[model samples]
Target chain A: METLFYDYVVPCVCAFLACVGFTLMFNIHGMGKLIAGVGGALSWLVYLLAGSTIFAAFLAAVAIGVFAEIMSRVRLCPVTGYVLVALLPLVPGGGIYYAMRHCVAGETQRFLSTLLHTFGMAAALAVGAMLASSVFRAMFPRLRRTGKG
Target chain B: MDYDKLLNMAAELGYQLMYSGAEIYRVEESARRLLYAYGLENPEVFAIPNCVIVSVDTPEGHPITRMRRVPPHGTDIELLERCNGLCRRLCAAPPPIEEAQALIAALPEDEPRYSPRGVLLGYGVAPAFFAPLFGGGLADLVSAFLCGSAVGVCLLYGGRFIGANGFFRTAVSSALASLLAMALVAVGVGESVDVVTISTLMVLVPGVALTNAMREIMAGDTFSGLSRTADAILVASAIALGAAAGQALGGFF
Candidate 1:
């Protein structure tokens, strides 16, 4: 039980709080903040359960994309802020740092590998979220019955 | 209705949306829909990342064009929401041109904003929690909080000293975060330099740009997407370069 709490619950809570913090910077307020926080936690949980690989980040991005879309429908706002903020945790800051370290330390092989991995991680996130949001909008042709397009 | 007023009003709305970091298609579509609502037979709305251009034909077939050059900006979801809501309302029942223009103009000031201090606190708290996600312990969390705040200070107040250039500003903040993380670990206040540094660096990542860039491409705005993709790459390189410089500087310490 303790291991599960430490491994899953703790990290998910941290992800939630971290996303709430980011909401302040991006000027999201009211229910949008809570929505963004939940989206972030959901993404982190998915990322962890999928095994924290590059593919894991892709799945997480898809989850966030769908989550944000639903929230946007519920609130009738744009999905840009939630998806942008929630995806930050998986953006590979460590990969970039390690790549920089390797490059500076003259480890060409490690630097190249890290750099490529970082690029892959970023690409996966972009494609995953983009695909999910686009497909969702397509499936639900009407954003609003009121013709609020 | 003064067609010139209508043209400028739509352009102004687009400008405000762009300033709030809206998607390019949102800006264009909103402006086009607004003009269409006002009974303009044909309207052309175009926007790149930093500029909004709106052209329309007056009732007499005279062409009127208005352009707004938006400044570099951060995302403000509240303002974006307000502008979008206002646009929808106007489109549903076209308002008087003067009244609509006033509403659009008031958007930037009318929206609520977190004070600078609160935003700085946000900067600190994010990295503090991010440390744990990176497998950091309590001490590393504290170290990250302090280092993140330092980067926040640089971002919020050091603008004049660091210049308004996004690349330089991000680089300086990245360097500051890494250097502070190293110092905190050295002083025995942190467990892992990597975790703390990475957490703080999270604040400087280009994730928003990447997502928005991909979104624009998906929406078929390839020109803006490519430009934003270039921006994301530049910012990433800046972070890498800044961290490298910070580490080298730390070697001397």
Candidate 2:
């Protein structure tokens, strides 16, 4: 368990910094900062423990989505702020960099493989977000629309 | 007074002005000293294109009532033009922070606020790329693109309506752009390479990453934000992956 947690720490830290950077860059609310940090960290942890980025992404998103919905209902933080920050960890930058670098270096076969893997992950991540959201929306019903839930 | 110094001070405080008209009242050295220098007021500053109006409704005992517009930052077509040019130049050249301060000070007054709406649309590579095809129309496209890009970057944070709308809008735009690219190829209007480049690049713009990033930090959900940021990175990677998939599929044809 300790080893597993340690493995996730790196990705968690990366997501945290990215969230902080975004907040500072855009000037978001304080509560928004907290929610985003928690969401991003948890999602990365899920990925590390499960070794499945898609599943991890889904779990994190759903968790954030549910939390945001509840918080908003209670008249606390804004739901959008929380969800937006929490989604940062799933962008796929490394894949693009790897593929582009390989392609530029003339490693055609490797580039193709890496490129496909990157796309697969990307598609999976989007589906995960959609699924998480849809599930939450179904459960809460109010969370689907903007004003009521 | 040094115009540049004034602008520099405001920017440092993260007070970027938006819009301007004309000054209604003048608070000379005494008012300036009390207001600007002493900072004895929590004024609500409303900005237009080239004007700034501040209402002195603080310190119930301070005898100052009504609103006033101060032109410490000048507003003329030339000034507006200069500021616009400066905005672009600074975005491109990115001078030292101190130098930027100086330029702002020299300008004499706030030009307007810098809104990020246009920036997101620019990344789409072309405006009206999906106006005719998408059900939501131009406004919808703009709103979605802006909201998605903002949410993606952690900019404005969330509102499920914005996210849902943004997702649907972007997907439609993506499909529309894709179709256009394909059509262009069919008509021989552009080379296959051009079609691929245009269509694929549009998909790579990371709206989710930006939005989530900001919300995570501001909400104090550092741990969660970190996870989401990773997810965002994965999403961006996936877009490139999608592009590659399309590329490979094209090759088979």
Candidate 3:
């Protein structure tokens, strides 16, 4: 567990940066930084736990969307602000880099697969937010009552 | 209802708002109040710095709203400072909504509501890079990298308007920024830029935001939170493209 934490440190920090950056970008108010940081970490955890990287990516995105809504309600911070941070853990920077590297190396098959993987990950993350929100509504009767409550 | 509080909120989030953009001022004020009242934070706006400012009167049988001119470009450091001052005042004596509405209605017709187009977009992108800093692992890094690429694709066309350059130029610029970022990472200097700063900087590229924005726009509202989301996606895509270009260059050696 200790080793896992140490290994995960880099991604968590990146997630934190993503969250803070989102808050700064959108000018979210009151606890924006904190919300983003926690949200990013949570998203990263989702990614880590899921069996497949793609599934994990999707779960993280959805988690962020739902969590953002929850933060907006519970913390009185901006949902978009939280979403921005939460989604940070899924940006796909390394995948793109890998794909490009392969492409330059004349490894066309590897490059294409990586490219597909990169975009697929993004799509999953983007749609995941909407799906998570729906699932939350289904599970929590109280949430549906307030219409974003 | 507390304009100063709203302004402070905007400032804290790094929104470059103009004092003269009263319509946006009103919208932002309303958003601030409503978000608090409804218990929602960072609710996306339909349009920023609304082009029109309206004053509704119910003196007759039916209430009607009248909008007047609120000029743009009056936003200055002075106004930002005033907002800071006002935030302090509001903290001391928060006003009622009715009073707040009246105050909003009383603002000079010449005041325009102006907001920097992508300020929120920029702020939104930080988490992708920052997650790793907080103990997120290779999974998180993978997420950031992929998300960055999608962001690059989104920015291919949308950035020209923001940068006032052509789409190709914007696309190339996005590629360039990512290239620079990759170089930083490859030479063992990625530590200096750090994951958070890189994500924050890339978030402004409109990569992820663009996808959300298009979806929202298609649903109905032109300037909704979703649209801002699309802008975010494109920005991210641009950054990723640049990074990919740089990585490819590095792999050559």
Q: Please, what is the whole-model Cα lDDT of each candidate in the order they appear?
A: 0.92, 0.43, 0.49
Summarize candidate 3's per-residue lDDT along A1-149 as a digit string, tens digits.
88776656655655566565455433344465677778877888778778547888888777787887776667532244456446755666556556655776789999899989977876787668866765765776444322121
Q: Over the stretch B1-253, how does candidate 2's per-residue lDDT look in tens digits?
A: 3333333334322222221111111111112322343244553433322234344434443433333233223112223233334543454454555666677556635433224553343333221222111222334344333323433333223334434343343333333334444444555544443323332333334645444443444445455446546655654554444444444444554
Lowest lDDT 10-residue stretch of candidate 2 chain A? A140-149
State the weakest 10-residue window (summed lDDT) of model 1 chain B: B56-65
* Candidate maximizing DockQ: 1
Q: Mind giving the per-residue lDDT tens digits that candidate 2 earns over A1-149? A: 88645455544664564454344323343455566666666665665566555555555555655665665555432345455545545544445645755785689999999878766665555455545555766676653322110
Rank by TM-score, descending?
A: 1, 3, 2
Tens-place lDDT digits, model 3, residues B1-253: 3433443343332232223222233344543443354233343332343233222222243333323232323223223323433433443454664554344333333233223434333333443455354333454454444445444434434455545443344455445445544554556534433352244334433434533443344335556544355445554555456555544554575
CAPRI quality of model 3 = acceptable
What DockQ do you compute for every candidate structure? 0.82, 0.04, 0.29
Question: What TM-score would you give candidate 2 relative to the actual structure?
Answer: 0.38
Give the range where candidate 1 chain A is weakest over 10 consecutive residues by summed lDDT: A140-149
Among the numbered candidates, top TM-score falls to 1
TM-score of chain B of 3: 0.35
Q: What TM-score goes with each of the models? A: 0.98, 0.38, 0.54
